[model samples]
Target: MKGFTSYAIKNLKSTGSIARSSKFLARNLAKQVPTDAKTIVELGAGDGIITRELLKYMPQQAHLTSYEISEELLALLQRIDHPRFSLKHSSAMDIVQDFAIDSVDCLVSCLPLALFPLEMKHELLTHIRSVLKPNGLFLQYQYWLSDKQLIKEYFPHLKTNWVPLNLPPSFVYTGTAPNSELVAE
Candidate 1:
């Protein structure tokens, strides 16, 4: 609760910020979060490092909704006073029920998707796809490619990029939801 590093170390398994060394990664991640996005949701908002960076770049009309189940991390996130920012003590899977379908412009996830159980991971990805706008962006970072195929199932248009500056390094996966009309055809 004291800081990003302390909270991450104390709750290593649950906290997504394994290392307080994501400065460069956060910057790049923030850059990818559509600036014109009217609504943005961030999953696993670890201590608001990336959230803070997002505030700096998001358009004046944009709003960032961050989700963090860890109270310790949430406390730090709450300290970031910004009119355009909001925090949710919830999980990514609830997104569909929490927001309207096709409402989100971008969803940035720092969650350890590879570690999630297969069924839960699929469920969450499904929810993400349902809540995203037709042209929405799904930006997720992970240390491994275990969830690559699962993500592909939900978002056929996908690209992967490496962020070597992050601690332990990570891959940034950018994806867009598949067109429902095309799938139906």
Candidate 2:
């Protein structure tokens, strides 16, 4: 977490933020997780800041699997030793290969979708839809509201919350999955 700025600077395309998420931003996102949730997935878990916050608010029985592509960040995430917590050193795109379809109760993402190309974003959103149960929760944060229309294609019941406490501020998007399943394109 100490070197977040440098890591983000070096890996802007993936890391996406120069600062570790503030507690305010983390809390805002965590509050949306269902209290009865059993399985939770975190995408692009850089620095494990948000991951830690989720652990605090989640039900004790809930298991959290955090995915990170950066080896260095994965090493940082490995420092967490909760029995309900696990880490995957893989891309979010490979989520279907790692978890069963319609198996997850909720998903919290910091994947920097705005930085990704439209097609790739579509694939990621599709994977998110594929893994979540009907009306499952999908939470993501961005510096802008640019992806709302795109995400609407996947999650029909989408809502946005503003967290100005974060550096440069952040917009948290909460989406409820449609009943229909999604296939990777």
CA lDDT scores, all candidates in order: 0.83, 0.88
lDDT of 1 by residue, 129-154 (tens): 88899979999988878788778878
TM of each candidate vs. truth:
0.92, 0.95
Which regions of candidate 1 are displaced past 4 Å? 181-185
**Candidate 2 local distance difference test against the native:** 0.88
Backbone clash pairs for candidate 2 read none
In model 2, the runs with Cα more than 4 Å from the true position are 181-185
TM-score of 1: 0.92
**Cα RMSD (angstroms) for every candidate in the order listed:** 2.3, 1.7
TM-score of 2: 0.95
